[model samples]
Structure formats: structure tokens, C-alpha cells
Target: MPIRLATTADLPAISAIYAFARTQMAKDNNPTQWGKSHPPLDLLKADITAKHLYVIEEAGNIGGVFAFILGEDPTYQQIDGAWLNDQPYGTIHRIAGNGKIKGTFSKALAFCEQLEPNIRIDTHQNNKRMQHLLEKNGFTYCGIILTEEQAPRLAYQK
Candidate 1:
């Protein structure tokens, strides 16, 4: 699968993927992470406009979407646990995949690594699947970081 920068044309498919992901998360016991609408349309549009959104395409179909922003994330400014390093890193956010695809996380991580070796991510405490994937991919649990909403997330870095 090849990852490409998302365009406004990709909005519909991206929205669908996220919608499915939200349902899946709820079923997986992580309902509150995204709630009804995690990554709002306007924010996703902003991500696309900023060239920070990417999608995994397979056979002309979009299977996954994510935001890879290179730089510090304001939410990560403070942590109850220390980061692995102080090196410049990229943050992976709003990563979601349609249930039809496997290895979406691995593929996305590889793509981000090509741009920057150090990567940071966060997940709601109940997001066990994501926690497992991140740990399996060598992402160390850095600590608790609060979202803009003041909700604490489990932060990880690689």
C-alpha cells in the first residue's frame, strides 16, 4: 500500500473510515476516546490543507487515514512521565483504518519513520488495541498527557 497526501477530494472516504473507526472503538470498549465525532470535518480539512493528512490507498480504495505532524505538539508540553528523548519528533494523530485492512498502524509508522525516526503518539486509556499496537511497534509508554479537553491520554514515544 502506498501512502499519499490527502486532498479535499478524499474527505468523503476519510470521513467514512473515521466513522467506522468510532463504532469499532466503542465496541472495543473505548467509546469515549472519539465520542461521536473525534476528528471533526473542519479539523480534518485543516489537516489536508496543511499537508499533514495522509491516506493509505489500495487498489484505488482508501483504507486508512492519519495525520503526521512534524514538530512539538502543544498537548505534549507536560507529562507525568518523561519522554524517551528530547530529539525533534513527529506526532501521529487521528490514525484510523477501515476494518478490511490489516497492518495499517505498522504501515503508517513506517511511513512516518521515513520522515523522522522519532515519533510520538497518544491514546485513551481504554484504547487497549492501540496500546498493544504501539507497544508491539516499540513505542515506549512515556506518560500521561492531557488533551486540550483536559482528558488524560497515555502518551508513547519511539
Candidate 2:
């Protein structure tokens, strides 16, 4: 699989992957993380333009999307619990699978690890799947942190 920077032309597939993610999150009882208007096209366009958005192609198709931001994440500055280290980190946000593909997080993590080992990620308290994926992939819980929207999320670091 090759992970590449996302472009405007990839919006349709990215939107579809996120739609599947929202539905799955709802079904898993984590309805508050992403709402109906979340990850809006405009926001994605901004990510693409900012060079933060990435897409992973698997088996000749776009199978995953995520935003990898380097540096201190403002929302993570106030975690209730301490981080494992005070080193610089990269934050992985808005990771979503293609619905038809498995191990999307694994692929994204592998890609991120190649660039930076000290990584951070967060998920809704109710997103058990993601929590498991994080833990299974070597992330340690760092307690709750609030998003810019004032929503509390379970933070983790690796």
C-alpha cells in the first residue's frame, strides 16, 4: 500500500470512507465523535491544501484517510493524565477505513511510525474498536483531553 497526500480529486472517495466511518461509529454507540456534518468537504479541502491530509491506496483503491499533524496539538496540551514523555510528537487525527478494507489503522500507524515514533492519537470514550486498536498498536492511555469544540476525548500516546 502506498500512502500519498490527498488532493481535490480524492474527495469523493474520502467522503465515502468517512461516511462509512460515521455509520460504523453510530452503530458502535459512539455517535458523538463525528456528527452529520463532521469532516465536511470544506474542512477536507482545507486539510488537502494544508498538506495534512493523506490517503492510503490498497489493492488499487483508496482504502483509508487520515490527518497527520506535526508539533504540539493544542487540544492535547491539557490532558488530565501525564504523557509518557515530554518529547515532540505527531498527532494522528480523523482516521477512517474504506469500510471494505481491514487493518486501516495498522497501515496508517505503520506509515506514521516510519516518520515519527512519538505519536499521539485520541478517540471518543465510547469507541471501543479504536481504543483496542490503539492499545494493540502500543499506545498508552494518557487520560482525557478536550477538543476545540469542548468535547472530551480519551487521549493516548505511543
Candidate 3:
């Protein structure tokens, strides 16, 4: 799979992948993490405009979407618990796959790892599936960090 920055033209396909992820989250018993309006189209559009969004294409299909943003994330500045490192880092957010492809997260993580060793990501406390994937990918639990909505998320670092 080739990872490339997302363009406005990729919105529809990106949205579809996120939609599938939302549905799968519900089925996995993590329903409230990404509600109906979570990761809104406008936000995705903004990510695209900022060049922070990316898509993994496989067989001419957009298999996944994610945000790999460099520098310190404002939301992560204050953590309820401690972080693994206080050095400069990049954040991985809004990572979702179309379910049609396997190793999507792994591939994305590999890309991020290549870019920088100090990578951070967060997921809902109830998002067991994501937690497992993060740990499996060599991320260690850091602590809780609140999102823009004031919802607490489990932070991780590698």
C-alpha cells in the first residue's frame, strides 16, 4: 500500500472508510468514541487543506485515512498522567480503515515510525480494538488526555 497525502477529491472515499470504522467501533462495543458527527467532513476537509491527512491506496482504492501531524499537539500538553517522553513528537490521529484491507494501521504506524520515533496517539478508553492494535504495534500507554469535547482518551506513545 502506498501512503499519500489526501486531496479534496479523495473526501468521498475517505469518508466511506471512516464510516465503516464508525460502524465497526459500535460492533466492537465502543459506540460513543466516534458518534455520528465525529470526525466531521469539515474537519477532514481542513486536514486535507492543511496537508495533515493521508490515505493508503491499495489496488486503486483508498483503503485508509489518518492524520500524521508534526510538533506538539495542543490537546496533549496537559495529561492526567505522565508521558513516556517529553521530547518533540508527532501525533497520529483519526486513523481508520475500510475493512477491506488488512494491516492498515500497521502500515500507517510504520510510516510514522520512519518519520519519527517519538509518536503519540490517543483512543477512547472503551475502544479495546484500537488499544490492542496500539499495544501490538509497540505503543505504550501513557495516560489520559481530554479531547476538544472534554472527553477523556487514553494516550499512548512509542
Candidate 4:
């Protein structure tokens, strides 16, 4: 799988993944990080237009996506616990996998590894699957952070 910068044309595929994620988030009883209004096609277009989203493609199909930003994340500054890293880090938000697509996490993880050594990701406190995945992939528990919506998230860093 190869991860590439997303384009406006990828909105439909990305939204599909988010739909599945919505169900998972609901099942986990976590606050909707993306909210019901997210992936508004227009929002995705803007993310693509600004080059903030990346997609994983395998066999010419969109398999996974993760929104990320370079440099220190403002949210990190407000961590409720000590972060694993005191250095600069990249922050990954809204990572989702198309349940119909295989190798999703593998692809996204590979993409993250290629970006930088210092990477941080957070998941809703109820998102046990994601937290486990992050730990399995070498990220250490960092702290909790409240998103823009004021939802608490368990943070991890590598």
C-alpha cells in the first residue's frame, strides 16, 4: 500500500471510511470526534486543497486515511499528563480505515513512519482498539487532551 496526499476527488472514499468510523465510535460510546457534520465534502475539499490529509491506496483503491499536520501541535501543549517526547512532533488526527479494505492500519503506519520519527496520535478514551493499535506499533502513552469539542482523548507518542 502506498500513502499519498489526498485530493478533492478522494472525498467520497474518505467519507465512506468515516461512516464506518462513526459506527465504531458510537459502539464505543465516545463523543463523535468528527461530529455528524464532518467530512462535509466541502471540508474534505478544503483539507485536500490545503494538503492536510493523506490517503492510503492499495490495488488502486482508497483503503485508509489520517489527517495530520507538521510541527508542534497546539493541543499537545495542553496535555494533562507528561508527554513521552519533549521534542517537536507531528500530530495525527482523524485516522480511519475502510472496514472493507484490508491492510488499513499497516498502510497508515507505514506512511507515518516515512514522515518523521517523532509522531503522536490520540484516540477517544473509549476507543480501545485504536489505543491498542498505537501501543502495538511502538507509541507510548503520553497523556489526555481535550479536542476542540472538549472531548477527552488518550494520547500516545513515539
CA lDDT, every prediction? Answer: 0.97, 0.92, 0.92, 0.79
Error of 4 at 18 (Å): 0.8
Can you write out model 4's per-residue Cα lDDT over 1-158, one digit (the tens) per residue? 77899987888888988888887677777546656655567767777887879998878998788877778776677988988768777778778887777667656776776777788888877778787788788889978988766778888888
Off by over 4 Å in 1: none
User: Which pairs clash inside model 1?
Assistant: none
Best by lDDT: 1
Q: Could you tell me the TM-score of candidate 2?
A: 0.97
Candidate 3 residues lying further than 4 Å off, grouped into runs, are none
lDDT of 4: 0.79
Backbone atom clashes (below 3 Å) for every candidate:
0, 0, 0, 0
How accurate locally is residue 113 in candidate 3, as Cα lDDT from 0 to 100? 83
- Point out where model 2 deviates above 4 Å: none
Ranking by lDDT: 1, 3, 2, 4
Query: TM-score winner among the candidates?
Result: 1
Determine which window of 10 residues in candidate 4 has minimal summed lDDT: 30-39
Our model 3 lands, by Cα RMSD against the true structure, at 0.8
